[model samples]
Target: MNTQNAEMDVESLQKRRRGCFLDAFLVGSVMFLFAAVTTLAVVGVMTVKDVESRLKPPSWTSESGPLKLTDVSSSAVFTNFAYLEATTSGLKNATMQWAVQQTSVGHNFQYDRTNHWMMPVQSGNYFMYVNLNFTCTHICPSGDFTIHVGEGVVDKLSCKVHLPKLQDSTAVIKKCWTVSSVASKQKLISHMTVPKEGLDNWSLDMGLGMFLVD
Candidate 1:
């Protein structure tokens, strides 16, 4: 009888041990599944963000447009000047306007019309840069412009402008003198003073210098 009782106790203990092991294995499997699910969720979110970025245009590109520079110089001593204009092409549903001023010097300036602008004219050469943002509601118009400057030594002026296109992050830099148009979007306009020596060599890619816009 004693032997029987002992055998029964041993069997019970063995059964309990097996049950514990099975429970532990089930818990481990559940934990592994949870971890896998979490990892997949994170990857999915990252993929969505990447897709969004790919769909959106870059800031520099989205904020630029067709750029033109007009040299208005008189045959006088240190009385040459220039102005810049940027227009939108194909961009629809946007209102576009821009203003430029010499950050270093003061001068009279105008936009959209003539005879209603003023700025303090300062000595020495200066750069008047403009930035524009707009949204059109009706028809998109081709970008066009004229830059005006007071009588001064209008040395060489360089323009660096970019316009962004939808579905791409990179901006298309309107090659200097090459005309570009946008029908509906924001555009960027930048003007800088060109060095006298660099202006002499128009063929070299100064990356930013004067070029004739035909």
Candidate 2:
């Protein structure tokens, strides 16, 4: 009976030793896996930082920074006028004419057409267009029609349309100008031109249009 007890005790000791070894192996494997994951995470962060440092402007940045420029702040406004009667007789060169009426569509914009000079009140980029149509007694000589815009006498922008030789019919002149970097307080005015003979019949459809852009 004493020998039998000794053998059972030896078997129990061997089983405990095997269990301890298995536990140690499992713990070591878990530790190694955790270390590898941590190293990979650190290397990935460093690589991203290095790539960001070498980047240049005009590219997207992931780091928290000022939002890139956008056109959301841009705005547009414009006003125009037209004449119902002939404002001038024998018109050959540039001249400013006031409108007796204003178009209802453009009154709410930035343009303030007190009379002939429908100038802009807000300062920004603006697109200005003018169309002057007329009638004549005889065939009118082909000439250039110009829309002159500026402060006082300095013509900053001029849009011109050529009138081919046509008489006893209709003559049309048009001009368009895209102005940039303008001051709000700067004095602005505009004028138009047509053939001398066509001036008497230049009574209808004489209109101007403008739009402001950011």
Candidate 3:
């Protein structure tokens, strides 16, 4: 009878140990699964943010760049100047980038790099001038380079510069137009085109200057 009792006690001890081990294993597995799910959620959120940023248009500052608001007490708001330099090798048109901001900017005007244009936040009469210089290694045969203060609109101002048939020469052109009147949200930007014949081995410099007259 004593032997039988001892055997029974040993069996119970073994069963209890197995149960404790099984419980520990189950708990560890659950923790691993929870950690994996949390990690995947974080990764998914990061990927969504990246995709949204890529879908957005390329902008230098904001919906618009550089605020246009100046105090009327001073004349600084009426004075402004912007310039850029670009070189083209192919026959394609090269759009000027306002990389350099020189001179005073008024509260009524704003500059946007994404569109490469200087726009007026408030409408008023403004005296606008555009200057273009093109230097080419070879002479142009057909068309002359055209420079404009405002291009592709009804009130656009333009100047055509004749390229002399001489290699290693520079053609200089300048034009001034009184934006006699501009409605609110109107833009006055500078644009120029280089002839396909003289695009090779050439450098072009463009500048736009404006002052509020009214």
Candidate 3, clashing residue pairs? 68-107, 69-107, 70-107, 77-106
**TM-score to true structure, per model:** 0.31, 0.44, 0.51
Off by over 4 Å in 2: 1-90, 104-115, 170-175, 193-204
Positional deviation of 195 in candidate 3, in angstroms? Answer: 4.1
* Candidate 3 deviant stretches above 4 angstroms: 1-92, 138-142, 170-176, 195-198
Encode model 1's per-residue lDDT on 102-185: one tens digit a residue: 111112222332322223232332333223232332332223222222223331222333222233222232332222221111
Per-residue accuracy of model 3 over 108-132 as CA lDDT, tens digit each: 6666767877676666676565555
* Poorest lDDT segment (10 consecutive residues) of candidate 1: 201-210
For candidate 2, write residues 54-169 as lDDT tens digits.
22112223356532222111212213211122255455555565443323223323334344454445577655544555555465666666667777777656777666666566
Candidate 2: minimum summed lDDT over ten consecutive residues — where? 69-78
All candidates: CA RMSD in angstroms? 18.0, 21.8, 17.5
Order of models, best lDDT first: 3, 2, 1
1 or 3: which has the higher lDDT? 3
Measure candidate 2: CA RMSD: 21.8
Better model by TM-score: candidate 2 vs candidate 3: 3
The TM-score of predicted model 2 comes to 0.44
